[model samples]
Target: MMLGLKTLLLFGLGGQELLLIALIVLLLFGGAKIPELMRGMGKGVKSFKEGMKEVDEVKKDIENEVKKDEE
Candidate 1:
């Protein structure tokens, strides 16, 4: 299981491979646009996290209500 997890995380990528990928992204997006792209991605991730937290809170509330009814 650990080995599988490691393989999934790295996908066997080495330093050179990662550097090449970064270069490709820089070339495709150019120097000026990368920061904007990253900022949008960061915002998207933050929104996703907040949505997940709200879902978890609602789930806990429902569970608590169920417990109250049982009592």
Candidate 2:
């Protein structure tokens, strides 16, 4: 069975639980900083994705080199 993102991240947390968590975050960070935090998170995720792509390209190159050697 393939577990979806909600199942993996939320782990059965209901709407009320999500709302409570959001409220806590709002209180701790305040509304003004939320946008900045989200922006930083977006940048971080973008960087991580780019890094993963580079790693995959390197792995493919290595595999191709091995195949060339074997042939």
Candidate 3:
């Protein structure tokens, strides 16, 4: 699933604006913490994708059962 916040953020941001934001983040978090933050984000994304897949599977199973009952 697409992240709504990500889509909303940076929608009309230009290159200069992006650079400014990056610089601010670097100053706030420092260089060393950025990698750790990105790694954690990656794990979160992976978990979210897995959860979505399971939801899809359950939905399909429910639909199939309903179809079988109709026959």
Candidate with maximal TM-score: 2
TM-score per candidate: 0.80, 0.85, 0.82
Error of 2 at 34 (Å): 0.3
State the lDDT of candidate 2 residue by residue for 31-61, as single tens digits. 9999999899889978998999999999999
Worst 10-residue lDDT window for candidate 2 reads 1-10
Off by over 4 Å in 3: 1-10
Relative to the unseen true structure, what is the Cα RMSD of model 2?
A: 3.8
Clashes of 3: 0
Best by lDDT: 1
lDDT (tens digit, per residue) of candidate 1 on 1-71:
46644774577776687688889999999999999998998899789989999999999999999999999
Report lDDT (Cα) of residue 31, candidate 1.
Answer: 95
| Number of backbone-clashing residue pairs for each candidate, in the order shown | 0, 0, 0
